[model samples]
Target: MKFATALLLIISYIAVASAHMAMLWPTPRGGFGTKQYNGRIHAFIGYKDNVWKVRFPCGGYAPGPITKMKAGQTINVRFYASGMRASDIKKQPVLTKSTKQFHQARHGGGMCEFSLSYDGGKTFHLIGRYTNTCPDAYFKWPVKIPSNVPSCTHDKCLFVWSWTANILPQYYMNCADIRLEGSKDGKLPSQSIQIVDFKNRKMNVKELGDGIKHRASTGPTKKEISGNLSGNIPKALKKA
Candidate 1:
């Protein structure tokens, strides 16, 4: 009887902890969900109670193998479900039919942004943004790699997915290791970003949300945050 009770307690915890949304596509190396995806899968990939770990890709978990693709390709992201209901997960690992739908508010909503990285994680640039609009699950975000992007001189680049919640100060982040081959005569992008931390102010949350509100863009952003970043752009990007 005691062993059964202890097992019950453990399941209750996973249900509460996995409330944040998980990114499904351009498919992060890690993939999504605790046990719902195909092949080998892991637990939810959100910041949740561990909000401070936003800086670490995949919540500080070592990333998965590289996802290979070419330049100017359209990237798509999928989520298990949209905002789910509470009763959805009361059964714990028994996984009621609602487990996939358990990602409701507290499941964290608000904004999502996609970016690209070259030079072995030294610097990254903005590639796409989705604001005030991701549904509970399976959001297909098809973003095309700019025709002017440089090829993987080395073989690949990092694809990053960042989500900020509206109900709390949590930020969810994940990255897919990608091998990108861009056009030979590449033109650099206008704007790029390098997010390294998080804040708690209401203003900060709105600011973070607002930053990604604009439609996907190219070239330096109209709104720039000044920093002394030392990472340099490639010759093709510099000319852009």
Candidate 2:
């Protein structure tokens, strides 16, 4: 009798412990819940009086709030997620093509003016104007491009590009960001592009162009560029 009573007590203790443990559910509405983000998948189970939360390595909470499970409901959570880098937040192509036309104009104080286009061939916008002063002669104005623009869709969408500016005399350069929005149907393609960073240092347009072209390539021709600007820009530009 003592042995049977001890066994019953042990089982009761296990049941109590299991009751305290949180349970995960696949769906919040009925059973446990599931969520996914950044290529990571998570399964959630809820227990009465138990609360759960998950965080991304890049420093952000999952899309939803903590889930609470009622008594007797088991929460199940699943997600196909990956780590997102700070640089990934800014990866998008700089430009689809050399849409800007070269022009010379005069600004106040006899400053030379230049313009370029964010669109492939739609419109031309002013880049900057500079005075002929020796110190000011080599100064380049910084331009921030919009976050969205349209580009041909092959497989995965590409967005964002960045480079440092080279101060030059008589010659001026410009950078732009283009952002694209998708159609309401969720089938139509949209794009966004922009110049996220600009500095007085000389920019390697040729290299930047080549990097974009490589990314633009399909199949075996596709190549990856070094630096966070290229790596994260495309992901940031992707729709949620």
Candidate 3:
């Protein structure tokens, strides 16, 4: 009789523990989310489905592929106040100094060196080097062209670069345009690289090549573009 009673107690304890764990750790809660506070924004990192949440205030969220995250993997949530604009919120700038830069060197119509800067152009850092054997020789977002040491005339060129920022913005709200530029002088141009900022429900496409464009809309007011590039790039680029 005593043995049966003890067994029942053990099973009861296990059942209670399982139920408690489930209530405390729900699945979708393991990912990432953002919030605003005290004239600044913050980011949180923890199991969207577990029992840990650390808040780090900064500019925006860059959701990554959830399928790539496995159990026990280390995740980082960072926040920066310098990336925010005046119209984002009624708050002061977090960082007094803000900047970012990217540079690429080409050889044989391909990228030979890549670097970037963020500290008001005071310093630069090497991000990568490239050649035919590199795995990212064909990735096409930040266009890569390969040709000569100072000339990009080759049909197959590669470009490499880094992205560094002294501080991230507080929020990326009301972004109206994005632009990119290429040159024959073998030097990186100084200008804003146009990107579609989705929050304000707006689209900004700057002239790059002769045949590049974009259009945007929502519900029944969607827009379209006619160029070599098709499909929705911004729709697939949202951070989780």
Using TM-score as the measure, the top candidate is 1
Report the C-alpha lDDT of model 3 over 154-176, residue by residue, as the tens digit: 21221212211111211111100
| Model 2 lDDT at residue 43 | 18
Candidate 2 residue-wise lDDT, 127-202, digit = tens: 2222221111111122222222222223122111111112211122111122224223332112322221223423
Candidate 1 lDDT, tens digit per residue, 117-236? 775445666666554443234234555566678876453368877665444555566667777878878755666653423543233342122222212112122221011111222211
- Which parts of model 2 are misplaced by more than 4 Å? 1-110, 114-116, 119-122, 131-140, 146-240
How many residue-pair clashes does candidate 1 contain? 15
Best by lDDT: 1
Clashes of each: 15, 79, 32
Pick the winner on TM-score between candidates 1 and 2. Answer: 1
